[model samples]
Target: MTKPTPLSGFPELLPAQRIAELAVIDHLRRTFELHGFASIETRIVETLDRLAKGGEIDKEIYVLRRLHADDDSSDSGLALHFDLTVPFARYVLENSGRLEFPFRRYQIQKAWRGERPQEGRFREFTQADVDIVARDELGLHYDVEVARVMAEALADLPLPPMTLQTNSRRLIEGFYRGLGVADPHLVISIMDKLDKAAAEVISRRLVDEAGLDDEQALLCLRLAEIRTRDTSFVEQVRALGVEHELLETGLTELAAVIDGCADVSSDRFRVEANLRIARGLDYYTGTVFEIYMEGHESLGSVGGGGRYDA
Candidate 1:
């Protein structure tokens, strides 16, 4: 008889391991309920059309296939969801009639992606998300609320010190457009790699692919280097000498978010205004978030999400 082989990405924990995992989930559920957030779970699969609405996600989806299809039979146009946010948004739209304004919900589920296994990265993982979605318009205060809730959640868990690095897509986009760059989105996609790639490599890509002059590329690299815990980042961006209404608005909004959290005495979890956090998703039009442990920065963000007003 042949020995059974385990699938590469799909992991099955031992009985003891799963018991420990369930305890953590219980803590999260209690914390969420304590904050008046209702729990809701969506189906594990979503339509490929919805998943691929944002072009950047095309490479990461795992398509579902039928078991007994003929040669000419096509896929069912469905795939396992890569993350919880996309599915949650679709659910809100479909059930808009039954839901209330400014809905507060918490979801914890497993998600699958087609990513290659690498150090500090995975193809299958569990994600816990807490979101406050609204009907007409969501207040900026909720943004700060999210930061506080997540920070408190992490503090409850047995983890090291954490820093929630946040930035505004509008802030970066406006900064680029103010420089007369025709495609700020493309510039942002490239700038997102600043952490993985060196400044020279990014500058070269900006010039060769994104069509930026050497001077403009250098300016972007300088901007991406700014990281601050307080409102000092506002001064750093202003010193760049690039002025625009969007940029001004973004700076003000970003400052307000950082300050709002700070005033809540959220010092248990450090928060910072980090300009280099682009989040890669185009729909993330407003502030973006990326959380990292103090000494485990190389592990990447343990959790992240942001405003997508559009």
Candidate 2:
């Protein structure tokens, strides 16, 4: 009898690792509930059009259908959800009248992505997300509060030291619009890959693949490389003659969040200017996040989510 081979990109955790994962899940659930975020579990499948609302997630979806069934004539195009946010959006839209304004909820579940996974990256992974969605608009304070709660939860976990990096979508969108970038989303996507690719590779991809010019790509690279412990990046960016109302607003909002976090302690949180963190999904609108473990920074972000308000 021949031994079976394990799948390439899919990973199976060991007994101890599984136990640790479960413990983490338990901690997250407890923290979320304590923060007044009610738990909600959505259906595993969503329609194609609903999933494709933002276009960023189209490449990651795993389409599904019944096996050995003769339903070829049917127009069913169900897909496994790539993240918790879209289903939450659909759920909120469907249950809007019955639900209260600023519906706060937390969902922890496995999401499937059909991309080629690398080391420490999986085709299917579990995500624990807590979000506050309002009917019209959620206040900015909620953004800071969400980050604070998430930071606290991660800090309490039995893991290495982590940093919470954040950026505002409204601010980025406003800045890109000011820069006259025809497709800011494309630029954002390219910028998101900065950590994975070299500067030249990312620059070429931005120009060739994203339709940005050489000068624009260099500017984007420069913007993405901006990092600071304080709000010094704001001054540097301003010195570069990059003046945009949205960018300024983003700078102010970032300052407030950094200051609020400083009240807790400066060591656990940082405001990174070069943190070109786009969650690469449709549901996130403002305040994106990416958490990095102390020594496992190259393993990619272990935890990430952001504010999404329509």
Candidate 3:
């Protein structure tokens, strides 16, 4: 008999590990259901064009093809979904007519990507996501609502303590535009790499690549450095000596999220306003989050997602 070699990214878990994983999944399912978030499932594959809309995520997608398909067949394209959000958005549009307004959905499924495998990185992994989709508008309170659900879910698990660090896209967007930044998105892309990139490297990129003046770049970088365990981040922004209407709105929204979280799991979980934690996705128009274990920065964010108003 021939032996099969283990693949680097497509991991295979042993029996004990699989058993432990099932227990975690069972807990999450129960927690989500208790919060009135109905469970739903999307197909494992979606069109390549749909996933491509994820910006830089386009490069990490894994396209699918039949082994015996003709070279010139007219099929447009197909790819394994890289994450649940893209597929869920498509689902909302496809089933809009039959569904109720303000749909709250909880999905747990395996998502695939072609990225390099590392300690907190995965090529194929199981993910649990809770999202609220509205016909036109989603209330800011749901932002806090979802976080509370996740906080409770984490507390029930047997893993080490974790903190759900949050930031607002509105906050960053308004702060940058207020500072006279030419391209805030470009600066955000660079800022997202701060953990691996040096401060000087980020500042230089902000100047040379994004064409921001020294003053603006410095302010943006300084804003990114602010981290608070509670609502104190509102004061930190004021201390920066800059103001914008959008910044005001974002601060209010973020404060609301934090305060709402306190009501749900005060002693069970932690929430922090981490300004530097900008998600690379541009669609996340409101509050954003990244959860990590205490003192385990090397493991990276174990779970995260936020509002996508579009």
**In TM-score terms, which candidate is top?**
3
Model 2 residue 292 CA deviation (Å) reads 1.7
Candidate 1 Cα errors over 4 Å, as ranges: 1-3, 52-60, 63-75, 117-123, 263-268
Each model's TM-score, in the order given? 0.89, 0.80, 0.91
Steric clash pairs (candidate 3)? none
Backbone clash tally (model 2): 1
Top candidate by lDDT: 1
Q: Rank the candidates by TM-score, best first.
A: 3, 1, 2
Candidate 3 local accuracy as lDDT?
Answer: 0.86
- State the lDDT of candidate 1 residue by residue for 1-310, as single tens digits: 9999987777789999999889889898888888878899999998888888756568989888877667524568889998899899899999999998799999999998888776646678899999998887888888888888877777777668888999998899989999888899999989998889988999999999989999899889988989998989999999989988899888999999999878543545788999999998467989899998878888888889899886
Off by over 4 Å in 2: 1-15, 52-60, 67-76, 115-118, 173-190, 200-221, 266-275, 279-284
Full candidate order by lDDT, most accurate first: 1, 3, 2
Task: Give lDDT tens digits, candidate 2, residues 215-274.
Answer: 777777777766665667677667656667877887787766666665544455443434
lDDT scores in order: 0.87, 0.77, 0.86
What is candidate 1's local distance difference test score?
A: 0.87
Q: Candidate 1: lDDT of 144?
A: 88
Positional deviation of residue 67's Cα in model 1 after best superposition, in angstroms = 4.1
